[model samples]
Target: MKANRFVTVLIVLVFLVGGLFAQGQVERKAVEVKVLAGVTGGKDDTENALFEKEMEKATGLNITWEKPPSGYDQVLMQKLGAGEVYDLLYLNQFQMYALANQGALTDLTSRIAASSVYSENVDPDELAKIQMNGKYYAGFNKLEVFPLVNVNKAITDKVGINLNTLNTLEDYYQMLKKVKNYMENTVGRKPYYPFFTYMPDIWDLQPWFSSAGVRRGVFKDASGKKYAPFVQAQAKPVWEWLAKLYREGLMDPASFTGKTGDMRNKMWQSQEIVMDVDWAAWTGLYNNNAMTAGTYPHTVNVVGLPGTKSPSGTFMLEQGGASLWAIPANAKHPDEAFKIIEYMATKEGGLLLSAGIEGYDYVIQDGKLAFTEVGLAHAKDHGAPFPISTQFDLGVLGTMNPGVLESVAIGKRADVEVAPMGYADGELDARKYYDIMSKWMTDCIMGKMSADAAMRGAENELRINSLID
Candidate 1:
């Protein structure tokens, strides 16, 4: 009887231990990953909360997202400076390069190599573009796109100018002049500025530089020496051309001091400007906004221009910087955080990021995705308008706002060369380069200095600041 009691007691102990082991496994599986995201899933707290729930369900892990709507760059620096720990953080390509140089980010080189999700979804060439000094410190959030010329075709039609024929610098100049004349005289709209280019950082001047056979940003010669193309003699004519536009009242004075928000408002809402340079994705947005305002397709029809031809006969368009997600060096759950990043590069994750929550933003009907009323209103983009996954099919998302497809298609043209701005290799200080160049460019365009003087002043400042040479 004692033997029987001893055996029963041993069996009871075994069962109890097994139950506890299973409970421990469950607890370990429920790890909560904290993220300080700046690029995606931070627009609305309620929406982000739902997004978090969806991400949690997909990854089988708990997630905490802290996304501040404004001043994200400053906030990111402050958080890292304070030694705050987060499993994941969102950053642009430049920020990734800067942080990687500082050793503040985890070296993701091996992690990405081992991840089958990355291999299957992201292109190797794409990864190569974002590498910092031969090592990857972050994963891509979205495919980088280029900004192109967006013109109000309705106004162009009124001027009797065909957008397809606009290939040379003189062509655009005459077109802008005609647009100004027609809008002021026929439409009776006073102060009808025809062209708008944001002078802050001298944004969207790539096309004009291409016309002079000069690519903007820092470049290396065959001898491995660095040089900036814009401050050089070849870029003089483009600078002079811009100053001429400002002098002629064809360019808005606001371009010298106004923000991008102000530019957008002038383009779409008030229709004060007939032409401006903007992102390809914004082609659809401009039309979508006009559609909401009940003036689309006829009164506010917008079209994308592949920009003026270079001397080599190719249109050089500058691609925007990549948006990335990185793991901080001090992150507690890097493995789980990388899992989330990997998921974002997957087809399923791409759908979530682009199309938004399934039930709330869309519904699957008859084995196909159908956008709900909310989804239609949502405009089919939560964060990434264009997903980074190679395996992802955007056709499943259905049609986008009008003009978007055409605008995006410009980069795919046979004669177009889409490249990123200089300092893309991340060896130079891009911020300093932009500030000095913009200041001088603004001084020249606003008639404070001659174009030659501006270029000389810029070259001197860039050399002194160690941005060039």
Candidate 2:
């Protein structure tokens, strides 16, 4: 009878442990993570649904992707201002820093230090780039691409210009003149302007300024004194060059007032502008769009030039700031949300982000990724064109857009200096600096004020705003 009682008690203990295991599985699966995305998603509901499903399956957490149709920046600000809770939020580097300053973001320093996946997949330098006061608050979304000079080779070719031979600001100016003359006289497009720049924030000027070794934004010397390159004497020639373009009608007057969409249209669709400083991705995108319009290579072959040499005798390209993912301080599932962030820093996660959902986006034919018609149409990048994972194989994503490989290779050149926009060790408010510089610089470029006067005004305003010491 005692032996029988022992067997019954043993069965009861087994049942209790099994029940607890089942409950744990259910709880793990029940964890919900809501993400508010700003940079990516919005392809369509179908694609968004597929992406969420795949992410959920991979991370083993229920993920809700909240990607606004438009005005994402405004939406982001509104939601955060109103104290709306979200597990994860997508932000640019500036937003990350701004929020970090407000203590709105969770400090991920300890968590990231403890993560093996991050150590294996993410570059330490990249992590260093996003740290605030030596503490991590976010993880990188993608490797930033730089803006450079993109010229329509077809237009340049018509003018008998060899893009390879162009190496100075004067060379670019001459090339633009030739294109402008050809478009007006030969192509019969009256008053043809060959260049465009968004002057509101003084966007797309880094390539031109790099010619004079003027780096954009705030920086410090070895003695730790803050200074802005644009307000220095070295920047005068660069300003004068732009004024020359504006005065000579080589630059579009609408550049000061037009949106980036207008610039893109002039670059690819209208083919009115033969040259402009734009993102490296735009080099490929230009070719791809032209190809879609059936005017590629021969008529609209857009190619990237590493711009004129800096004083250091190297091509200087400024990287766009980082796109990142961060968890809010009020997140309910901080630990679970971090699991997603950690997973994203893995090879498997990189594959999903780059190649899209397996079987849906691609199929294994002969042990290789064979993209479907849908995948072929979309070009396979959900958010990260270059995944943050060091272990990721880019070849798995298949062919890139035309002109992309050539443009991307420019960053790897030994003669090139690919630098980020200077931030004075994260003490600078980029938005304020941009506004102050834009106000004064527009006057200079538009001939309303002398370059020296504009620089003086910008410098004073910058000092008042504490953007520079």
Candidate 3:
């Protein structure tokens, strides 16, 4: 009787285990999610096929990537305007802001608040940048400062200029003047390369004026009025300062243009430019090139060219994210959409998206993120494992090309200015704003119109549009 009872008990236990295993195998419906992927050079369907397949397997979600041929902002705006809102929308702050006010995207305040992934993984400072009116509408991108002053020490020695004496606009002018004279006298009229390059865009010009405490896009004045630098009273002196450099033949008028490779060739390739205010990634790359080719004798020295003497510690990347992903108010499968986001915040999703399939695409080398033979080959064919959907892996960045970290110039307040909370009132037109400002800037710098004239005209336009007062 004891033997019979024990056998029966064992059989019951096996049945219970079988039932639990079968329950776990219940298949979930594969949710089809349409996403506007603006971050990746997701240039073509073929380019992202492998990535899409990998993501689908990893997340148990189907995704369709809609990539615009060109002009990401314009394309995203167009889709929203035409009432073709996709399930997932990825956009920069301005683009997101434009739609966010219209009640288009979902308010993710509560969602992020409840999410353990957001609270635990995401940095507090990063979370702060993505908030509007104390609510998070989008996920924050990792912030990185690229305000660098890469000076060729060899050239500076030849010109008899010391970077240690650099302070205020007057000091900067002297440095440029010394270099300008050296180039003309020693090298002849090849071209005067003043370390000039704008990252992200020409509009994000913080490296040049941050020291004097000027923020790009929108900064606050002494009166606490939020305004763009071009229209601000404080910016006048800075403009005058730059104008002085231009007029003195230290700054080349021809260098300021839409053309590419003009500044790079002079600064990096030709080795003619003396001082460059740019990002570390490019500077580090240049350093590598110089080292390899024996072109530049000395390493490109880092310059602290922030306008103010107080030194604003390390400058923050104000607009760090390209576009914060948002779900449209008129979306189906909202649950699935949130699921995707939640999964993305997980370590599994982050690795899959950033480094690709570990054994297949990448592998750990010395406990650091390293690409395998497979990853290198794929990178050569397609773009490397840059997960545009998220911040890739912060860990990978620590092990990344080392140029990115070396490019960071601490103690410079790049574009330190004040900006009032929220968007400019009324319908915001980014195209008109950028167009007018770009032309005005080039005009002012190139001498087509005076800075005062350009500012006055721009102020009137911004005021009319209710962008500023």
Candidate 2 stretches greater than 4 Å from native = 1-30, 220-225, 425-427
lDDT of 3: 0.58
Per-residue lDDT of model 2, residues 81-155, tens digit only: 898999999998878888888888999999999999999999786677677767999987777778888999988
lDDT of candidates 1 onward, in order: 0.87, 0.86, 0.58
Order of models, best lDDT first? 1, 2, 3
How are the candidates ranked when ordered by TM-score, highest leading? 1, 2, 3
Residue 235 of model 3 has an lDDT of 67
TM-scores for every candidate against the unseen true structure:
0.87, 0.86, 0.74
Q: Residue 80: error of model 1 in Å?
A: 2.2
The worst-scoring run of ten residues by lDDT in candidate 1 lies at: 38-47
Predicted model with the maximum TM-score = 1
- Evaluated against the true structure, the overall lDDT of model 2 is 0.86
- Distance from true position, residue 204, model 3, in Å? 4.9
Which scores higher on TM-score, 1 or 3?
1
Runs off by more than 4 Å, candidate 1: 1-30, 220-224, 373-377
